[model samples]
Target: MPGRLQHKSALITGAGSGIGLESALLFAAEGAHVLLVDVNLAAAERAARLVAERSPGVQAAAFKADVSKEAEVKAAVDQAVALFGRLDVMFNNAGIMHPADDNALNTEERIWDLTMAVNLKGVWWGCKYAILAMRANPTDAARGLHTGGSIINTASFVAIMGAATPQLAYTASKGAVLAMTRELAMVHAREGIRLNSICPGPLKTPLLMDFLNTEEKRERRLVHLPMGRFGEAIEIAKGALFLASDDSSYMTGTDFKVDGGLTSCYVTPQGEQVLPPPASLI
Candidate 1:
């Protein structure tokens, strides 16, 4: 059988490493022409090479763009269409957490500003241009990739459940993503373009592992997970694959939680939680 994403083109931000890279690879494997977008040109190039190698003749490419910047994001979305004839899926997955985003009182103004700039504003820029690109144009219509596509914004499990782990800026930014995705989905549902958010639980990405470098910190997070382990990037990539394809043709404005049951459990075989959720920090 032909691949699910056959003839589709997908632009994945943050594709240099972690979930983005894995998703690029998986999308290519499923027959989507992949564009690996990253602020780091070299990293995007490296990932493009890997995606190309893994899926021969799949037409993988790389582009440099800081999604937070409007011009760069516009250029990337335009270039993806110009290079591949049309864009069919857009994955907005770049995000970060700062060391100083501990709590509302302790968080610095600079940290909150930077986090929102990159995490929230960045996603808005991507979606804005992606819809512009996906809107059926005379040329795109002739090419058969008419106005309609999937927009997958990466939110987090923390967006739904309050976490004692802190990272207030990160949490707030993701909450904004979930809200924006829902609103946009409703606004565009009749227009053919579908939008949704993916809420991944604690993953074994370099970013999270580096943050939890100490065993004490890792154990604190592990205890909250019903699976008793961090999720793998590929696992979340698979979830993106399902959304990118027509398999989710009826889905939109939904929060797909690929969280290893992390957000669902109240108690487990181990206990109620090695550490209780901090009593509502008044």
Candidate 2:
């Protein structure tokens, strides 16, 4: 039997050293022709090499493009279609959290501007181009169904829940992503295009760790984690896989929070189970 995404083509931005890279590898393993895109050519190349090592015949390639630029993003998607016949999955996963982005009062103007440019506007460009591509081929002749594709935007749990240690700009940009995703999902529902956002919690990615290099920084964020640990990049990649595959054909406009139970918790971890112990039936 073929893999879940057999014969499909996927373009994943931020496909360098974290969740995006892991997802590229996993998608290739499942038989999608993966296009590994990133701002760093070297990083994207490294990821492409890894995918090739696993599946030599796979049409995996790498492209360097800053997601913040409309032309670069459009060109990347066009390149993927040229190489792989169609763009089946467009994963707009590129993003940044500037070190200076704290609460609104403390965050600098530059930081706020940069965050919206890359996170919010970048995702908008991806969706715009992907929709244009998908619209051209709305019905899969083989399946005899609407053949539009999946557009997965990387939002954050912070978009849904307020953070006390506010990366105000980051949180705000992700919130816009969720809202845009829902609107796009509604507009394109009949066009067969499914749009959704992945609202991930604090993962142990370079984007998070580079700022929190000190143990104190780590603990300050980790204490609130209900799982009591930072999630691995691969763990989040699995969620992307489900969204990309046909298994989630009915899913759209949904914000899938892969936050290790953090969003549901009423209290932060105090290095122990602080909740009252289950009452004994005496």
Candidate 3:
């Protein structure tokens, strides 16, 4: 059977591991020719190889690029279009968490700058070139079979709500992402380009797991979660699939919260939990 992204070409940044890797594989499985971009060439190559090995006939390639750099981001977009004829989607997923020592009063200037460069400027750079590439096809005839494109930026739940413990730079950067998405969506809405942001909550990724290695920290995060468990990479990928596919054709300048109900309630009763409602509730 034909897949949701058949005949589309997608460029995903930060595809070295975690959600980026999972989403790249998922996009390829759904028939997208995926360009996996990462700072780690080896990891990107391995990811592409995994995609090719698992999904026969799916086009997959790896590129080493720092999304924070405009030249590198532009080149990646150019490479994707050159290889696949057009750029159908751009997933600006490259991001970093603040170091444990990062706090309001003690965060270093260098750390804050680095985090901003990768987390915020990176997405801006990705969107900048992705929009230029997507707009390359001025006419319907030149638009290729897919006709248009989509842009999805990775944001965090912290962008929406600030916690007592502050990763100052990370929180600030993500907040900017949410605002940028809306403006970009409006600017490109006429070009047949759509932009959206994915706000992921506490997820079970290597980065988070490593940070929460201590039982104390893990419980601290878990107690705030209504689901009482962290989300998987695949769950985030599914939300990404919606934004990347025609399924969300009319959606732009919107934020999807894939947080297991973390943002749904003001407060869950102290001892009670708010689970995904039963099947019948649907």
lDDT of each: 0.89, 0.88, 0.87
Candidate 1 residue-wise lDDT, 147-221, digit = tens: 689999999999999665778999999999999999999999998899999999998888887777789888888
Candidate numbers, best lDDT first, in rank order: 1, 2, 3
Candidate 3 local lDDT, 199-274, one digit each (tens): 9988888877776667887777776677777888878888999999989999999988999887775654566654
For model 2, the stretches where C-alpha displacement exceeds 4 angstroms are 138-140, 143-146, 273-282
Q: For candidate 3, what is the TM-score?
A: 0.92
Top model by lDDT, which number?
Answer: 1
1 versus 2: better lDDT goes to: 1
Candidate 1 Cα deviation (angstroms), residue 63: 0.9
lDDT: worst 10-residue window of model 2 = 273-282
Clashes of each: 0, 1, 0
Residue-level lDDT for 133 in candidate 3:
86
Error of 3 at 271 (Å): 6.0
Candidate 3 local lDDT, residue 169: 86
| Residue 175 error, candidate 1, Å | 0.5
